[model samples]
Target: MGKIIIYEHANFRGVSREITSDISNLGRLDFNDIISSVKVIGQPWVAYEHINYSGRLMVLEEGEHNYVGRSMNDTISSLQMITEDLHNPQITLYEHPNYQGKSRVIREATNLAAGFDNDIMSSHKVQRGAWLLCEHSDGSGIQYIAREKDNLPHYSAIYLNDKLSFLRPLRPGQQLCPGGIALSSPQPCSWHPGCHPAPRGRNSNSRSPAEMGRIILYEHTNFQGLSKEFTSDIANLRDADWNDLASSAKVIGQPWVLYEHSNYGGRFLVLEEGDHSFFGTKLNNKISSLQMITEDLSNPEITLYEHANYQGKSRVVREATNLAAGHDNDIMTSHKVQRGVWLLCEHSDGSGIQYLARERENLPNYKAINFNDKLSFLRPLRAGRSY
Candidate 1:
């Protein structure tokens, strides 16, 4: 919590009020647009010119102000505290995606064109005001508006992987896309931002050839633990000491088609370029064979069934968080998606282990993706306004 002392006079004289919480309308308290001076203690705050935090905006840091400044003087009507480390205005940068590996914090607006050029920087979390990130050193290439508390998982999909080189804070009057979350990281501008940099290996391989084509499978979520890459079709995962042990995957180049049995038999599914956390039941640790397929870019869609092999009750979905409130744990088997991508979960609200479904057909058994008649939820690719 924080406290703000608003004075009706410019030099802290006359009627005054101290606020420690959100006030949508100050008029009710007889302090509407009378603010002339201010003093803030603890967290930062944003004061709006009109009621309900609308109209002009003002960012007040933790300090004493004899006057409210030219832009916000006597125009403040409503205010809300922004929870952050007020002592310092900085952003944390992670070396690897998903807030992994080494890390560093940037306090002032800086450029990474020299020593740090096109290196590290996989994920980030803003601790202050809005930040403008650019791919080029001089602020050219790709640009993204990062607001406070933004958590970027990965930059691969946005063509920003190891591509960010500059950053600066966004000034007043500027605005960002609004809907759900207030922050977003280097997400792709569109579905097709050209072929992304060759697949990057999390552990085993450090290879990214010009024409590289490989898919890496992780034994754990968040791309941790042991991992292996595949470039050609494998008749059996056991042949390489890796059978029924794939929990996550990162695709590159062409798409990969997986199977539940050796010799490309049993239940089969396709996967494009991206990262997957949960592989689900039968396919989780039961993958037996896989073959690469040509890349395809199109809208994704999926259908869920009450029984395996496209049987019984079924539902089609094209977006995220398809609630299975009444039908929780009522899914089994499947016919798979014909276009785009999706993640099948064992719990409702798209939580728990997520099973990837990409152009797969006839999953007579839910054993491959895990749970049998226990599917609770699903979500389409690219969450919110951006991926």
Candidate 2:
């Protein structure tokens, strides 16, 4: 059990309340919306804006909050102990672009209106957790979900599409589902296979857990509109009235390849174990067939070669990095992204012209951008967070 002390005044003075367990509604103890300072011991806690833990949140670690700060003073309505495998509170909000100007480092969910009521956030740094940057106060209005490792240079290109007014850090694996179709059942499988359930006795009503990978195709970007789930390769999507109309896709179990022509022929893009909002450029709305990639390419990788069809000096990338440090001047004539979407850039730091690659196979040249050896940098394509 964890213990937390809340004070009515700063520096731990005034009438206070001590909590050892989760309190969904602090109002029962006459402690609603009147917190100024806090001291936590042994466990982390999450405070909410309104009673019953149903408002903007702030995760507090074991420490002393001498002053709850302006954004959250006298505004905490409820709080609860956090037992999930959450990360330590470490998020920084900025008032200007590129992490410039005034800023606030938040270790808990916060309603900007409470403390920084007049602040307009233009950038942020999320060290962990999937955070939602809400446009309006108290976690409402247009919002953008920023995952771990996301370093957005501009907020104008994402959800809310402008300054952030409020922020909330979500527990790991949390899906915001913003304006997108919600899957009835989200699979446990991902790019890295481990926790997947083993095959058990067959129960005629259900397929074996071994075939748990379910691929969903959508007619619009970000998993919107009509969708169909499949556990097997579809050589012909026309049979299901879904030919050449796929604009987005979400994958589970293993990664799958989407073919532009039926029978797994013609150009194809690989949809890995994540969501693909937009195919980008010529790859969008041109899928005719798809099939699960059984070959276990356990690691997400992209290999760039100086020669066509896997030849010459090659550089394999598994994480986002500046290629200019080592291979800046090398000519990349061919490339292969085995399990994740990658953006090939003409310059380092992903600022120059780029191309999004989501599938496997050798590209003799980047004909889309009309360049071959021009790629000087590369990074993984992230869903819902990429500009």
Candidate 3:
């Protein structure tokens, strides 16, 4: 069994209470509307907004959460432990309500692919384990959690109808029991002092570097000056005292996008796995937010427009090509990145100045970045391709 330590104040301070079993209502312990921080050991746990596991929910993974996020802080009224094996989780999504219409069985994390991608799902059925559905491909925006269920007839009841774009199973934590009451052999707990002994099993921090994803930002160019390493998304670097301070960076596993404004707004740059000594003139000391791309990049697509604002002639490009060979050289002034990241180069051999564009709506004017009428070679960036 797992354990949860709820705190009365942020950063795990003040009065604390340890729980090793399900609690339908915190009011019974006089802890309702007062939990501010928490630390989880062993299996992952779920916190609910109302008693009896009803209303809003947040999954608490292993490790300490100094603050339980704005939406869940001081609002959790119920707790439930996830004891089922999630190693091979699975779920089936339906195109219409009551399990009707087309259906797709999902067994792994994915940014919904073509045909069924976007807001097309109206219902679902979780055959095993727990799954998380997100409103955006990058796992941002609204979200919903679904556990083992034979049928979820409608999404309207959960306010997630036609809004899901990403899906991933919530993997079980270490030392989870088969059901919910069978305790595994006891082991010394190293996370907290005076806490209950932990169960012996895989360490929660044993995931591979690729799964964790890391990026180090440096204040000065050439990997000099102040620096900080991050393993998760930062909607606003200002909160970490690092806004507009990164002149160079190093991506260890997955690619990351740096935004010019907070909350993932404005122009952006995608940095693939490798060392970056400089950010160039466009983004030097100007980054304000960061987001990691966790989707597969095997298939890429983009549309180029002959004139600005998606007007005039256009062509879809899926692979690296010399535009001159197709009589489309030096003519593209705008483009829409339908999928994956792309590199637009000024020369046919992919030399000279280049621009990185990610999935987004039409970029109406290349002139804004001094690239108008200069396109010659273009290609989608793939994994293991150094930037």
Clash count in backbone of candidate 1:
17
Q: What is the lDDT, from 0 to 100, of the residue 114 in candidate 2? A: 33
lDDT of 2 by residue, 201-298 (tens): 56764645665566888767888755667779888776555676678887766767788788988766756667789887676877878877554344
Model 3 RMSD in angstroms = 13.6
- The window of 10 residues in a row where model 3 has the poorest summed lDDT is 176-185
Model 2 spans > 4 angstroms off:
1-208, 220-225, 263-270, 275-284, 300-318, 324-326, 333-372, 377-387
lDDT for predicted candidate 3 compared with the true structure? 0.81
- Can you write out model 3's per-residue Cα lDDT over 1-387, one digit (the tens) per residue? 688999999999999999988999999989998999999987788899999998777889888999998888889999988877777899999989998998888886655521234688889999898887887765667777788874789989777788887778886766634433224436433443344544467876465645547789987899986567888899988656577778999987768889999998877777888899999898898998998876556788999999999899999999988997879999999999888778888899876767778777579999986889999999887664422
Residue-level lDDT for 273 in candidate 1 = 67
lDDT of predicted model 1:
0.67
What pairs collide in candidate 3? none
Over 1-387, each residue of candidate 1 has an lDDT whose tens digit, in order, gives 457889998989999888978999999889988898888765566788899977666666666788887777878889876654334457887878998987777765455643333456888888776666778755666666557888888877566778887765543321112321112224432444442333334865444463356788876677865567888878777655456656778887666778888798776555666787767665776677777653232466777677767788877767665456655355556646766556677677555655666665446678676767677777554411111
Off by over 4 Å in 3: 112-116, 135-143, 176-387
Q: Rank the candidates by TM-score, best first.
A: 3, 2, 1
